[model samples]
Target: MDVSCAFATALDSADNIALAERLGYHRAWVYDTPQQSPDVWMTLALAAERTERIGLGPGVLVPSLRHPMVNAAATATLAALAPGRVAVAFGTGFTGRRAMGYGPIRWSFMESYLRAFRGLLRGDVVEWEGARMRMLHPAGHAPPRPVEVPILVGALGPKGNKVARELGDGLFATLRPPAFMTEHSWVAYLEWGTVLDEGEDTHSEHAREAAGPGWALSLHGAYEFGGPEAVRTLAGGKEWLGVIERSRKQRRHLAVHSGHCVELNAADEAAWYAGGSGTLCEVTLSGTREAIRRKLDDYRARGVTEVVYQPCGPDVQRELERFLEVAKSDES
Candidate 1:
C-alpha cells in the first residue's frame, strides 16, 4: 500500500516539509481550516519548493466557502508551481461555513460550484455572476495553460459517494471503511493516525483510544472561534442557551468519566485534541515493523491504494522520522 503523510497547517514549516521529503513520503496533505491554520495555497507553494518529488495538495477545501473563480485562480497557481504534482479535493464545507455564520449549502449548489471549478482547471470558460471567465494563457503557459491536476471529492455517505464517482478523479474519505471505495470502483484512501514506535502496549492503547466513542463538536468550537457575539446572534438566545446547557452537562460527564479536571467550556477543546490524537494513531500503520506490515497487508486486502498517516499531538518532525523508518522497511 502507498503511504502518504497528512498534516494540518499547524505543522507546515519548511523544516517539516524538507524532512518529510527526505523520509520517502509519497505525498504531503495540508488541512484547510480558516481559524486554526495557515493559508493552504501558501503552504502548498512552500512545501512544493522544499520537496522535489512528494505530491502536495489540500486534504480538502470547502467549495461553498469561496467563489469558484477564486478557487480556480488559486488552484491554477499551485498547479503551475508544482506542475504534475498538484491536486485538489472539494467538500461541502459544513464546519467552515458554520464558523463563518453561514448555514450549510445544498449539495446541488456545491455540485455546480465544483463543476465550474474543475472546468476552469481544465481550461474551459466558466460562468460566474453573468460574466464568462476562461484561462487567458497559452497551452504551456501559466494560468490559462492546461494542467492535469486530479480533483478528488470528499464523500462520507452513499449520495456523496455517487457524486464523487461521477465527478472526481478519486475518493478521499476519513473514518470510513475501504469497502466503501471498492464498492464504487474508485481508488480508496484511508485517513489514519499513526506513530512510529513498536511497543505492543502503546499500539494497543492507541487502538483502544481509536475505538472510543467521541462527540463531534462541529458547531460549538467553530462558532466559538467565529466570535462570541456572532455565535449568540446566529444561534439566538434560546438555541444558544440550550447549547450552553448541553455543553456543560456533556463536559461534566466527560470529566467524571475521564478523571480529568476541566471546565465545561473547555470540553470541546479537550474532545477535539483527544479525538485528533486517537485518529492519528488509528489510521496509521504503527507498532513493530512486522505489525505495521501486517496492518498494511490487511488494508491492501481491503483494496486501499493509499493510507494517509496524520500524526497527532505536536512533535511532527519526530513522527516524520518514525514514519520514514517504517516506509524504508517496507521498501526493503
Candidate 2:
C-alpha cells in the first residue's frame, strides 16, 4: 500500500510536506481549511517548489468556498508547477464551511461542480452559470492543455460514493467506509492519531491530550453529517448531542487547530468521554506498534489502496516518524 501524510494548513505546511517526502512518504496531502490553515493552492505551490517525485495535493478542498472556474484555474496553476505529480480531491464543505457556521454544500451542487471541474481539467470548454469557459494560456508558458491531474472525491456514504464514481477518477474516504472499499476506483483512507512506542503509556496524559482533538472532530462529524440514526448509536450519543447543542447555542469558535485541537467546548470534553480513558479507536489509532501494524494490514485487506496518516498531536514530526517506522516494517 502507498503511505502518505496529511498536514493541517499551518505556516509550516510546506516544510512538513518536504519532510514527509524526505522521510520516504509516497504522497503528501495538505488540508484546505482556510480559517485554520493557509490558502491550499498557495501552500501547495510552496510544496511543489520544495519537493520532487512525491505526489502532492490538497487532502480535500471544499467546493462551496470558490467558484468552479477559480478552482480550475488554481488547480491548473498548481499542476503547472508540479506537472505530473499533482492530484486533487474535492469535498462538499466540512471543516471549512462548518467553521463559517454552514452545513455541507448540497450534494446536487457538488455533483454538478465535479462534472464541470473534470471537464475543465481535461481541456474541454464547459458551461458554468450559463457562461462557456475555458483556460486561455500561451504555449510553453503555462501547463499544457489537459493538465493530466487526477481528480478524487471526498465521500462518506453511498450517495457521496455514487457521485464520486460518476464524476471523479477516485474516492478520498475517511474512517474506512465499507461502501468506499467496494467502489470501482482508487481509494485513499485518511486516519488520525499516533502510534505509541514500547515504553510510552498508551493511556498517559500525553496520549489522551494528543488524541482528544481527533476524537472530537469524529464525534462532531458523525452528529452533523451521519444523521440521527448514526448519532444514536455512538457510545455517548445523548451527552454528546447536548454538548454540541450548547456549543452552537453559545456560538463558540469551532475550528480545529494545531494543539489539543478538539472543536468542542473545553469544559464538555468529559461529556463526550474525551477523558484519558475514552475509547479513541473509533476515531484514531493509538496503541502499541504491533497493534497499529495489524490495523494497517486490516485496512489494506479492506481495499484501502492508500493510507493518509493525519498526525494529530503536539509533536507531529514524532508522530509521522512513528507511523513511518511501522509502515516500513510492514514491508520487511
lDDT of residue 308 for candidate 2: 89
Q: Which window of 10 residues has the lowest lDDT sum in candidate 2?
A: 255-264
TM-score of model number 2: 0.89
Per-model CA lDDT versus the true structure: 0.59, 0.74
The C-alpha local distance difference test score for the whole of candidate 2 amounts to 0.74
lDDT of 1: 0.59
Position 317, candidate 1: lDDT: 66
Query: Which one wins on TM-score?
Result: 2
* Candidate 2 lDDT by residue in tens digits, 1-332: 88998877778888888888888999999887887777988999998999987899987989888888788888888888887888998888777777767778888999989888878877889998999998786786567777778888888778887898788888898754565575645888887776766777545656665665666665566655675456556666656555455555435335221222433344335435534235665467667779888888888777788888877666777878888999889768
TM-score of 1: 0.72
What residue pairs are clashing in model 1? 192-283, 193-280, 193-281, 193-283, 193-284, 194-280, 198-287
Model 2 residue 88 lDDT score: 92
Weakest ten-residue segment in model 1 by summed lDDT: 255-264
